[model samples]
Target: MKNRTILLTGGGTAGHVSLNQALIPELKNLGFNVEYIGSKDGIESGLIPDSFPDVPYHAIASGKLRRYFSVKNFTDPVRVGAGLVQALNVIRKTKPVAIFSKGGFVSVPVAMAGKLMSVPVIIHESDVTPGLANKIAMPFANHIFTVFKETLKHVPKEKSTCTGSVIRSELMDGSAAKGKEICNFNNDLPVLMVMGGSQGSAVINEAIRSNLTALLKQYNVIHLCGKGNADSSLMDLANYKQFEYVTHELPHLLHMTDFVVSRAGSNSIFEFLALKKPMLLIPLSKLKSRGDQILNARLFQQQGFAHVVEEEELTPERFLAEMQKLQMDEDLLVDAMTNAESPKTAYEMAKLVAAHTKN
Candidate 1:
């Protein structure tokens, strides 16, 4: 009999872990044993365990893969090698029929180990362009899944499929009333949610904080300021709430939000689109990323789903102007989103992954 086991790996950021989190329960409901392998220090390490206490988590050594010269570059390869060894051992012990990876530096060694052990490796790339980790892991994968059709051009097309975005089911069931209650706000003003991805963005934080007084004049603000970034001075302020991070509360928060200002990670942008929330997207600068968010943001803008403000141009004036524009274009953006292709449900995506397992 085929081993009814599946191993999931990914995590440097919440983006890498979010899809896996969405998949775990579905995979388990499909009667497959789901386990996770991720970096010992990645957000996944805590997220997976906290979210699903039953699933076994295997932490492995991982090092960031960087293009720029770093003193750690020479040493990181050593950690990668160690991660490969640890992953191989985990695979041997668990004997998973398949390994599913969401693209992150922590996943590279897991994919390599899966290939070396003759297990089928599947990768999911959420960006319009493949990330460096996915690029490195592609050749080792039996098949690749992409959130955007545009990504097919960057990866080997023969083994790749555009599965589109997979949204978490619970996100759809959020209570807007509960969301407002969570923030202790009322319907007196429109709600604006500002997020800077899972880790938070200093630039975005500063922009929002500096303009908080002006923003609170017109809209109640929910700011996910990232871990360690929240200002104590702002804690007592009415019409504004700040969180370092939130997991279960995210859906409710999003549900109550009238507008969003966020970095253009594919997962987040897609969630906003799915919810028909008008948004102003501030993509990470090329200096900070491989320009994937730039592509993600531009595509959303082209489709009239969001307003794009490149990080380099995100001055206070520009930020406020874009917010006004987003407000003015809300109906058009919502209409565009309503007509856009629907995202695959977690159950559907789970079945797709399960189909590729070894029998």
Candidate 2:
């Protein structure tokens, strides 16, 4: 009997899982059984199960692949070895024809296991530069897909394709009316959606909170403040809604937003572009990241799709000023977005991946 199962792996942050989330239904429609391998306690553990209750979720041990010196660096290799064995077991039983990895620390072991098992592995890179995990996993992959054309310079060009971004279809189905209702906002005010990534940013949170009173004078605010970061004191503030994290309701909130203030994660910035939302992007500094977000933000700025505010320069005053500037440049930004390349639909992306599956 031919194997029709497709295994998906990636998770540490929400970005790693979101593309898989978008592709799951499309893969199912194409008659492939989909399953996920992720870290036991990573964000994907909750996201995959909550979003697709029936799909099997396999938990495996994973260690963070950090650049900085850490004591765990010595212990993590053992965990990676264990994860590889666990992944091999899952691949043996499931007999997936192919494994698609979205490139996080958890994905490295899975990719290695897939190579060892002779299952074709496909890896996707969402940034201009390949992340460390993806860099390590690239050799194990049969093919690679990149969201940015510039990424080809960093990966093996012969096996890579720049497929652009793949956006979740549900995002386009949101209603502005539902969005307003979700926020319990009534008065006429431009909406500003603030996202600080899945785990939240203390710098962003502090800047927003300090300037909330001034910001309320101009616009309604919807803050996705990350888990356990919500302030109890601000709970009663009118025209300001704060959520620790939002899943299904995100599209609706985004639909109602007139402007966005967010980190420069490629998946997120591209979604904002697709939605024609003018944005002020505060990318993670080079000290905190490999500078991929900085590159992503710069490209968007060059294209006139967004405005950039470096984290080092961010203050309550600067944040508000940038918000005002984003509003002023809204028309130009929307115009630029209108001319930007459309994202590949999940169905199209699914077909592409399906084409690569072993017959």
Candidate 3:
């Protein structure tokens, strides 16, 4: 395996990139060389370089796979064609044993190139249903890994496996004491973590702000408000803290969290579930998204891991009510999470990739 170089590609959002981040350490431990392909300006280019400094990073042209009509739609196909050529050139040079993609638009070209170059390509889909990018890349993919068992029916059964979400080991290393120290939160009050993906959600932030007085009565809040979403005026409030985002401190933050209020992004929800945190989920409405998050939230609710309130209905009053219900059932959520059957999926997925590399 030390002689094998595995090419990895995914980007656009933290969800797409973080799964690859979770797998990198395991891949390195398995003694494979890692090389990442991402867009020149996607979130991956910024995150992967810093997270995997030892791994070689390659940038390629990428286009967004928009579901709506827009002027950019006219030119994005041209960019996609160019990206395919760029990926082909890189694949020819790297000649990787296999390519594993987390399925962003950036991955589609690389997956096609891998197919043309006679290299096996594996893709991981993190949602309950495949995203548009994964749908495009599936034909080129030799195997597809899914985070949810329900996602299997949506893809070609022969190529799909419900491997579950890859929960990063780093997340479990967070210290409650260290988290308290970092956030200036006291152990007397329960800590609530509010996260809205990497970009942060305006609705979530605004609801938290509008309800801070009431929320602070029972819980201290550690808000990861995304880049530029922090309110300077709220800095002086006790039992409340906000950050644009956390890099190294997220594990600690998770450790301190007794309950979570979050968007229903599959990656974020699964990480919360892995930690046994009771969650109140506000999924992105169909108006704003492809409705995957809505499905994610509902399934988590059905599985007894979370409670869901759609974005259209997510006022501070409703959020607070749901939080109270979640708090009352905290023990139940923990019990369900404890008995949940996703042990070592990340390791197994890594091993599967390694096996394919040999073929």
Candidate 4:
């Protein structure tokens, strides 16, 4: 069977790549060949090639247009302008049937190139709040998919579809039983999963530390500590599992977890929902993160999948108190998560893009 070529572009973080990753398998199942286009700096560089060796990888150079100022921002436009030209050359060479973008600064060039080349350019917005890049690209896109209904306000309604988030489907119905055994966890006890996105969350780690002794008495903790936090032994308890990184065991980790504590990155949010686990989201507000995490958590809070604890309010006491509330209300939490849209996300997104692209 001949495969239709799809040129997928997106990534500055795992949020973008995770969505891209989900679609690759789905698109391929439909007898389509997928190629990736992203920048050198993002996690996509390492993840894309490793995850899908069958796919061709293309790289573009770009400097982020941060919401805040730096010397880099001043020079980014020229670099990105060059990227647009280079990406145009790639689109001309590959002649892909369609382009799917998970918008970030890096996606700008290729999305623009697709527009110039008269290719169908589809974008998927992963957050409740659209980022600066996606907001700009909306007008030019043939179709745009957003995870949040709120994003429609920022993006042109004509170009956008609220499809929820695209996540790996098997996660929706998978059992955490296997993970419980692999992690050497006890099923009788509740397991709390703490992760700070793909890179790890230091604030979450510190908060856990301050409250660890208290938390351990009630919950078995599984912490993905990025690559640099103290080892699992730091817990000084027998019930905790800690890892600097656990790419292979991520699903299992989520499966075995009774609940989650994570940053507001969209990938983590959807994954937790896919697992139907309750979560406490602590958004990054200290830097130029632009409160994407905050917005993500706020939406889920409105839906009852999570509770938002701002960094300022995220002390050991508050963290523990929040967990206690969730523990007390576990059944309601489960009901809320089970009712949330998920598992069919990639299929929903793929169907939308396919129909639009065909038109």
Give per-residue lDDT, candidate 3, residue 194.
94
Write down the TM-score for model 3.
0.97
Our tally of clashes for model 2 stands at: 0
Q: How close to the true structure is residue 6 of candidate 2, measured as C-alpha lDDT?
A: 98
What is the TM-score (0 to 1) of candidate 4?
0.92
Per-prediction RMSD in angstroms?
1.0, 0.9, 1.2, 2.2
**Between candidates 3 and 4, which one is better according to TM-score?**
3
- What does candidate 2's lDDT look like per residue over 8-123, in tens digits? 99999999999999999999999999999999999999999999999999999998999999999999999999999999999999999999999899999999999999999999
lDDT of 3 at 335: 92
Q: Clash number for model 1?
A: 0
Evaluate all candidate structures by whole-model CA lDDT and list the values in order.
Answer: 0.93, 0.94, 0.89, 0.80
Least well predicted 10-residue stretch by lDDT in candidate 2: 1-10
Clashes of each: 0, 0, 0, 0
For model 4, what is the alpha-carbon lDDT of residue 159? 71
Tell me the lDDT of candidate 1: 0.93
lDDT leader: 2
State TM-scores per candidate. 0.98, 0.99, 0.97, 0.92
Clashing pairs in 4: none
Model 2: lDDT of residue 108? 95
Candidate 4 residue runs with Cα over 4 Å from true position? 1-3, 173-175, 230-237, 286-288, 341-343
| Residue 260 lDDT in candidate 1 | 97
